[model samples]
Target: MKEAILAAIKAYDTIILHRHVRPDPDAYGSQMGLATIIQASFPEKQVFSVGNDEASLRFLGKVDEIADELYQDALVIVCDTANTARISDRRYTAGKMLIKIDHHPNDEPYGDLVWVDTSASSCSEMIVSFYETFQEELTLHEEAARLLYAGIVGDTGRFMYPSTTSETFRLTAKLVHFPFDRPALYRHLYEQSLPMTRLAGYILEHFQMEEGGAATVFLPEELLTRFEVDPREASGLVNVIDSAVGLKAWIMFIQEGDVIRARLRSKGPVINELAKEYGGGGHPLASGATIHTLEEMAEMKRKLIAICLETV
Candidate 1:
């Protein structure tokens, strides 16, 4: 599969990269990391990474603004996004060929060449592996290393999550050898604003822990307004209560416009099934879902509580 992807890259003169919507570190990491590598290695090719700019992740790299006509005869590669609906830009299909590289479950599987490795820590990790496969033909410099490193660290929770394997650490060790500033990258990826800090305090204080080891917090629009934090920013605090004792799993529900977004995390139980029931899916330990109403959110809580109970 890596050989085929490499062949595709070599064959195309114009390549466009994309990732999931409402981007995270991993999304930008894999998409732009691969782009940087290709751009450096093949200076003649027109490479572009397109998506709505994620403000918090701009420290790693900025996205390119390319004309839609560029997709003509272009090779489009999407990273970290599992399903077609979650892809950021609609122009992904406009290219001559479509490739999907992701670390999530391959349920939807909507590309001409699909490579989904759930065991991999993040899509960025897979990108590193791709470069390693063709080291002689590919170029991986400081910027590519920094972006891919950030993705692996973010998805693995700074190597705290269970997804981090021996290979993850080994590849991460290689990434750190680059000249990029690790301390600055860490600061950029994790630093919170004052309002976000206040919101975290509120979540820590008010989050409820159920008897079945299911912890939950509901951040309605009103509460978000009180803290003056954007709903998108509040998603970062989903793991604020992860260290709470006896917590088998946790869910953070943040109101976003007419829909409520649920970020689910687990220590043991598989919660992606629950996420799937609500029209969302991701890793078993970490998944996300959307709720249309407060009643639906309550039902989701009940279902999560039941899942935790079963695991216990």
Candidate 2:
């Protein structure tokens, strides 16, 4: 798959990169890191990273303005997105050739060439490994290494999550050979504003646990307005319940306008299947879903509780 993707890259004069919507560190990291490597390798080719406007992690790379016509003869490389709907820019299909590079489990493989490595800790890690595959011919500098390392660290939860592996550490070790401020990266990724901190406090006080160790944090429309912070930003507060002993699973619902976006996590159960039931799918341990109405939210909450209890 890497060779096929490389062939496509060599064939195209213009290459475009993309990631999922509501970009996370891993999303931006893989997108930017690959773009940097490609630009470094083929300085003659024109490469652009396109997606929904860059948000929180734009510091990794500035989102570029791209004309739709440019994609007519381009090779679109989508990183970290599981499916087409999750893609930030739908223009990917318009490209002359499409490539999918991701670590998430593939459901509906959309690309002309697909490379999905579920064992890879993160897409950035996969990108690093991809570079290592062609090391004799390609060069990885600080710009690519730092962003890829940040993606690896972010997705692995600083090596605390179950996804962290020996290869994850080894890949990261290779990146450190390049010069970048690791401490500053942490500050940028983990540090939060005062309002967001207060929002975390609110979640702590408000989240409730049900029978059989299922926990939930629901941010209704009003509370979201009260907080004056994007509900997506508050999504990280779901970590507050990670220390809960005996908890099988947890879900936090953040109201995003018409739909309630769920960030679901599990210590034991396979919840990505459940996420698929609720209109989303991601990794088995960490996944997300979108609920249409209050009724669906209640329905999903009950179903998650059942999963926790092993009653369903």
Candidate 3:
């Protein structure tokens, strides 16, 4: 797979990178990290990262905008994304050749060269493993290392998640050897504004914790303006319920336009399979889905609670 991906990289002079919509740190990190490493390793290649901006995350890396004509002969690499519906820029199909490098379960194969590693902790981890195969040809620098490390940390929950394998630690050990400031990277990743802190308090106060060890959170669209935050930031609100002593599973449902987007997390149970019941799926411990109404979110919550109870 590495040979095939590297061959595609060498075959095409222009390359465009993309990830899922409403970008998370892992998405941005994997997309930007790959582009950075590729550009540095193959200096002659034109590599670009494309997506919309989350103002709160621009401190990490700037989003790139390119002309549509460039895709005519370009190689597109979609990272950290599961399916086409979730891709930020639909124009990826315009590329001359396509590759899918993802850590998500292989539900659909959309690329000419597809490499999906479900065992990897994150897509960034997979990229590190990819470059390690041809270490002599590729150069790993501080900028790329910092971005990749951030992605691994974000997706692994700072080495606490079950997916954080020994290989994850080994790759991360070498990643931190680079010149970037690890402390500064962490500050940027975890620090929140005062309003965001207060909103987290609100989320905890309104949580619907069931005796069955499941918890549910509901935040209406109107709360976004009240909190003066981008709707994208609401996903972090789910973290408030993560550390509760007896909580086995939790879900955050934020009303976004016509759909209620759910962010689900579990301490022991396999919840991604439940996420699959709706139109979404992800890692076993962390997942997401979307439903049409708050009532549907309630129904999903009840079903999820039942599943959590069984796990207990």
Candidate 4:
């Protein structure tokens, strides 16, 4: 990991950070945390975090936007994303060197130097651990600490996921020293608006569970418009199905125009390989795919159900 970081810093005077599109707290956290570290450590170098506009996560931090003219000889560091297709910006490849740091199970390497560990709970955890190894020479600022904390908390479901380990807690302990309000962060995360709460209730009540405890929910785009909630507000719905009792696997398909966006998750046994089959990628426990029509997504879900039945 140090080799990759050092090589990137030495190769380019400017560093641009990127993560997956449709920004989540974890993606935003890792992006902000690493950019903060590089900027604070090497004051002479210019580091930028570029991706989507992130209208929802604006409170976390603002992403830097540099013109395309600045792309020459720049180093692009992509964090937390498993596939190049999911990366927020394809323009990142214009950089002289690409560096990837991720904790997802897939080994679809997209960078000159790749550091991927499936055992880690989140990519932010991997970044923090690697930084700690160089703690003697590097520093951790409050901005970096808070952002890292947000990633750790978000990805691990506040340490509820099976991937959480002793190292995760150890790193959490270290990050708290920077002095951020824990309660406020938790509130911003767990607290939802009344409309969102109502939407969630509707989703849960309408959810259907097949044999072998595989649950599924299909949300039409019209429902989102009716509730005045954006796509980001629907992010937690798949996770909610994942926590349902006796659910071996779950899927959430949202209809938007001609496309049907699907989020797949499983607790055990069943391997829902829908992501790779349908032009997306992520971990075994969590994956996503978007298809041209609901019929296509339904066929994919049917395949997943067949796999789950065979496993059972």
Candidate 5:
């Protein structure tokens, strides 16, 4: 599959990259990191990464605003996005060919050339492996290194998650060889604003725990308004209560417009199954779902509690 993707890259003169909507570090890291590599290696080819600009991730790199005609004959490659609905840009299908590179479950595979590696720590790690596989033909610079490293770190929780395998560390070791400011990257990725800090404090103070080891916190839009934080920014605090005693799994429900988004995390129980029941799916230990109403959110909490109890 890597050989096939490489051949596709070599065949195209104009290549466009994409990631998931409401982008995270991994999404930006993989999309732009691969773009940087291709642009550096093939200076003559027209390469662009298209997506909405995420303010928090602006430190990594900015996205491009190319003409729609660019996709007329372009090779579109999406990274870190699992399903079609989650893809940031709808123009991904306007290209001549489409490639999917992701680390999520291949539940809704939608590409001409799909490459899904759930075992890989992040899509950025897979990008590094791709570069390493054909180092002679590919060029990776400091910027690409920084982006890929950030993706791996974000998805792995700074190597704290179980997804961090021996290969993850081995590839990460290679990324550090480039001359990038690792400390600054850490600061940019983790430094929280005062409002976000207060929001985290609020979450830590108010999250509830069930007898079956299911922890949950619901952040209504009004509470977010009180904290002056965006719904996307509040999602970052899902792990604020992860270390709480007797917690087997946790869910952070943040209201975004009309739908309530659920960020689910578990230590042992399989929660992605629950996520799927509610129109979301991700890793077993980490997943997400959507709720339409407060009543639905309560029902999800009951199901998660049952799952945790079964695991125990």
Candidate 6:
């Protein structure tokens, strides 16, 4: 991974950084942080962060993107994306060299050198490893440090997620040395607006649980329109519902314009492989898919219920 990164840095005159679409904090953070580091270190080279916007991840930094014509001799660094389809831009393939850095359970290689470790809490953690390996030569500026720190905390649920480890903390401790207020970041992440709070309450009121303790919440198009929360804000609502009493697994059914988007989560042995069945995929513990209507979501819930019951 280090060699690939170093090679790409040295080989290409123009470096383009990209991440997943509808990006979570980690995805945007890693891209901004790594791009900042590269640009600061190698001022002679042209570095650009592409395919991200300021809407979803506005807290991190100014998101930058360049035109497709610029990818001719660019070395692309793809961060925090597991699958090719999830990559925000298809023009990444046009780069002179491709390097993928991710933390997902995939064996397939996406670029010249692929680093995929499911055990790492997030790609930002693995990027920290690279920073450490090149510590002698690299100095993480304040912007890079802040962005990386946000990625670490966001993806690890503030270090509460299971994937967090000694290495995660060690790297995080190193990152904190750079100046950024931790409290401010936390506030921006967890604090809720009035609309968001009301939306959460409404979703909570509609929660249901199966006989086997699998929780489910179905949000019809009307409710979503009434609340005005973007689909991004409603990203992992099922996981929130899973905190209900005796909950083992959970599902959130959201009605988009013409489709029902499903988010699934499992505690144990409750594999929601519905993502795989419906042309989407993620970890067994967390997955998602989109269906045509409420009836299709009900059918998927039935499948998930069967899986949860068998686990119990």
User: Local error of candidate 2 at 276, Å?
Assistant: 1.2
Report the C-alpha lDDT of model 5 over 182-271, residue by residue, as the tens digit: 999999999999999999999999999996999999999999999999998899999989888899999999999999999999999999
Give the Å shift of residue 119 in candidate 1: 0.9
lDDT (0 to 1) per candidate: 0.93, 0.89, 0.89, 0.82, 0.95, 0.80
- The C-alpha stretches of model 3 lying farther than 4 A from their native spots are none
The C-alpha stretches of model 1 lying farther than 4 A from their native spots are: none
Clashes of each: 0, 0, 0, 0, 0, 0
> Which segments of candidate 4 are over 4 A away from where they belong?
none
Misplaced by over 4 Å in model 5 are none
TM-score rank order:
5, 1, 3, 2, 6, 4
Q: In model 2, what are the clashing residue pairs, if there are any?
A: none
lDDT of 2: 0.89
Per-residue lDDT of model 1, residues 1-312, tens digit only: 999999999999999999999999999999999999999999999999999998888898889999989999999999999999999989999999999999898998888899999999999999999998899999999999999999999999999988999999988888989999999999999899999999999999999999699989999999999899989889999988888899999899999999999999999999999999999888899989998998998899999899989986
Cα lDDT of model 4 by residue, 128-166, tens digit: 987798877566798899889999999998998788999
Which numbered prediction scores highest in lDDT against the true structure?
Answer: 5
Q: List CA RMSD, all candidates.
A: 0.9, 1.6, 1.2, 1.9, 0.8, 1.7
Candidate 3 C-alpha lDDT tens digits along 1-109: 8999998998899999999898877898899999999999999989999988777678779988889999999999999998888898989999999899999998988
- Superposed model 2: Cα runs more than 4 Å off: none
Q: Which ten residues in a row have the lowest lDDT in candidate 3?
A: 229-238
Which of the two candidates, 2 or 5, achieves a greater TM-score against the reference? 5
lDDT of candidate 6 at residue 86, scale 0 to 100: 90
How close is every model to the real structure, measured as TM-score? 0.98, 0.96, 0.97, 0.93, 0.99, 0.94
Candidate 4, lDDT over the whole model: 0.82
Tens digits of per-residue lDDT for model 6 on 91-113?
Answer: 88999888888987673569987
